[model samples]
Target: MLVEFRPHARLRGKQPADLGASVLPVVAAVSASDTDLGKVRVVCDWVQYRNNFRDVVQLRPILNGDLEIAVDVRRAADAPVGELTSALLRQSPDRVYLEDWRPGRDSCVWRFNALYWSALDLWEKATGRGYEQALPGGESDARNRAAAAELIGELFAVWDRLAASAALPDELYVIELGVGNGGQAKVFLDEFRDLDRHRGTAYYSRLRYLMCDYSAHVLDLARETVAEHTERVSSFVLDATRPRTSLGFLRYKAFLVYISNVYDNLPTDEVAQLGGRTYCVHNRACLPGEEAAELAESVSATVDELPALVHKLLRLGPVLLAEACPDHFADTDAAVRFWQDTWAALRLAERYVPLAGLDTYPLTDTLTGEALRPLLESGADVRMHVSNGAVASFVDTLGLLHPFGKLVCHDIFVDDIQGYRTTFRGPGKYDGSVVNWVNGPLLAHVGRKRGFDVDYAPFRHRAGGHVVTMTAQVRD
Candidate 1:
């Protein structure tokens, strides 16, 4: 059977006027008997669902936690939440609508690591257009294209000051991370060339514009796109989270580090405050081959195996595939294709497990766990971005800048934690990648800790966009 439910009347469309009260009978009936199946279906953009109940089932919107409720089904009023959840999940393949939680450890959203390491190439390969075409406002331009232009205007102001002061090196450097299609790089280089010519500053001749990204394929394309500025342009394939490793040669030398919509794409873990307690959100990833486009149940993973499998695939995708089939090692591209398909079909089941404290938060392995404690604030119930990757990336990039240098970035940012609790911030899909609202306030707080001034303001040239320009520099 299929059912439709709403959390509230005014939220979006229509459900029953008394939907919440009306669905109690249906839920209680299913919980009492095993023959009747009680499944959950999330009616949100992040997930898609199909069953006979679409027009048949009547559900009241029991919108509580993402993976916490099974139409509020429980054995009794006092049944424990974890036990109830485990029991509900064991009831065959029932539909469970989850908002922000996940099922277990190591079950990441998958879209992000997949994109950065492999699917990024698939983005242009699968589609003739570049990945940027997936931008909401359409075409290769970001919906915030106006803001990109605004970013350039501000860059010039910073540059003019640096040039006049003469404290910066003669080899003035402007490094842009995540240079999509080299459009911004092209525009920036072209503008700098002209600006130098007009001002007779000779800045263009001495300019070293370095473009960095995770995808070598994108870098090659960007190289071709900006061929006109070959003399002053160079490109490096580097990880955004650890900029200083490849960037060591230019340490404390680059005058400006520019980024656009890059931080939001980096990996992040979501933490939530609920009923005066905190929990780490996790997801159990799967491939139900029977599902519309996903893999089948035969290939579905066990709880422990899920993380191990994802890790093995990330570390030795081709080797593992070949070990399973020795004859196909010669056809490397075919293995790549299978991996791409798997990533595309990947789906996550959410679960929110309670946590002990900040000391045990997961990002600690890759980032300073203690540094992130402040971001997990306690107040009126809310959720916030842990932006571990962004903070790690930002801190490393800051160290690479010269004394007169600064870091300029533009992306969807929540200037306050309340924005996350009240607004529709996301881990939404963009092409084959994930786009999140990087925690701006958290980044600023960390910046101040390192003796730097980090400030956020609406992109000056635009009016109505979530994009904010973040500027970070050593305190004057």
Candidate 2:
């Protein structure tokens, strides 16, 4: 879809003029080729001034192929062109997916986006692929299903805590920033039903959850799933970084936000701007061998040029900051060496001098509480706990453990008590399996590093699989 904004020539000025006497003209256009695409054009009709108001006119065309709008303005001739341009640009029309389209004024754009992404995720899962394989370790349905169950359990637990605190709003509207699918929402709904029964009131009506995602296909699946539960759940298609343009209502309404499994895809500044009482989750994987090799090579080459390249780019400075090396893989030193060697090989082929003395961590141990304690102690809040789950043996064992696990209790902590069963499809095979990376190492690291109380529970589904859910709270 294409969108553009243009302001009429009449509203440019240096000194403030009476906006009430001025009329501003604006134009917006959007185009789309997809049959399922839905678009909305919002044109602010009036620019409110300190003393009075200005009428902003809007023109809409009827044909569905493309949208072109024009507005007439009669404003002060000395008005700032930048200000005028900014106002018009803010209202640009864009093609939005059907999942993100809200028919009335009461639309939840964020929810629609979440649902849209979730639907696409489901399709990817159903199809056994994704746009890109960014993480190491092959994808598996068992892993995704187990992860979904764990995520749902976490959401329910959070809701319970909020409810118990008695500080929750009478009407809770939750917007999960990166809700991949309705899996977590489903868990929330189930928990809400139980909470309703316990509280002896229709708590469901007071609660609304929305999922926002970037993909329309995913939102469709999320919408379908949410519809099966209750109308309170909805989906929206949105880009997280530019949510304001799509989810203007969020600025006026208060909501508890959840961002999970999506932070790695965003930059730090963008993450900081996502305001709200938010629960954020991030997962990082070890880089694949090839990518790691490339990284090491680049670093080595920079070092060889020495004082110039390293000092200019790699050194810590006001204008430039060195990029942190990816914290994946078993041997940090070996990974660095691979890069250095690759660089040396390149230099030798070109008959250039080699550079040495690049320091690298030789430790083979997996990242532990001790290693990460410095980061935690540096006064950085632990937004979310980190975990790794690529161990083949642990994954295989989880499949075995799933069959016997009983769904004992599920609230803040999903507890399933049962014995182990063997369901591992073997190496390279994708099946739903849960392992120690989630339950053991991750829980341990968070608990020890952040001095947080942690709880681990096993959930057994009648369908036969074990999923472990863990919760942690940082120390006061």
- Measured by lDDT, the strongest candidate is 1
TM-score, every prediction: 0.73, 0.30
Q: Please, what are the lDDT tens digits per residue for candidate 2 over residues 1-476?
A: 22222222223566433333332322111222222124333222122121111113332322233232322222333444234444434553221111121111112222222322333343245446653232233321223444444544554455566668875457655565555445656665666566567767555677767777666665665577667665787677776555545555544342334443332232210000011111211111122234334544555533223323222322322122233333222243433333223222221000011112112211112332233233223332222122222111112112221111211112111121100010111011011111111213333343444344445654343233333434333344
lDDT of 1 by residue, 194-302 (tens): 7668867777788899999887877887899899999999999998989888998998887789888789878777776655567666655554434322322223433
Stretches of candidate 1 off by over 4 Å are 1-67, 70-112, 115-119, 139-166, 292-341, 360-375
For every candidate, C-alpha RMSD to the true structure in Å: 7.8, 27.0
Error of 2 at 105 (Å): 42
Query: Candidate 1, residue 52: CA error in Å?
Result: 22
Clash count, candidate 1: 19
**lDDT (CA) per prediction:** 0.61, 0.33
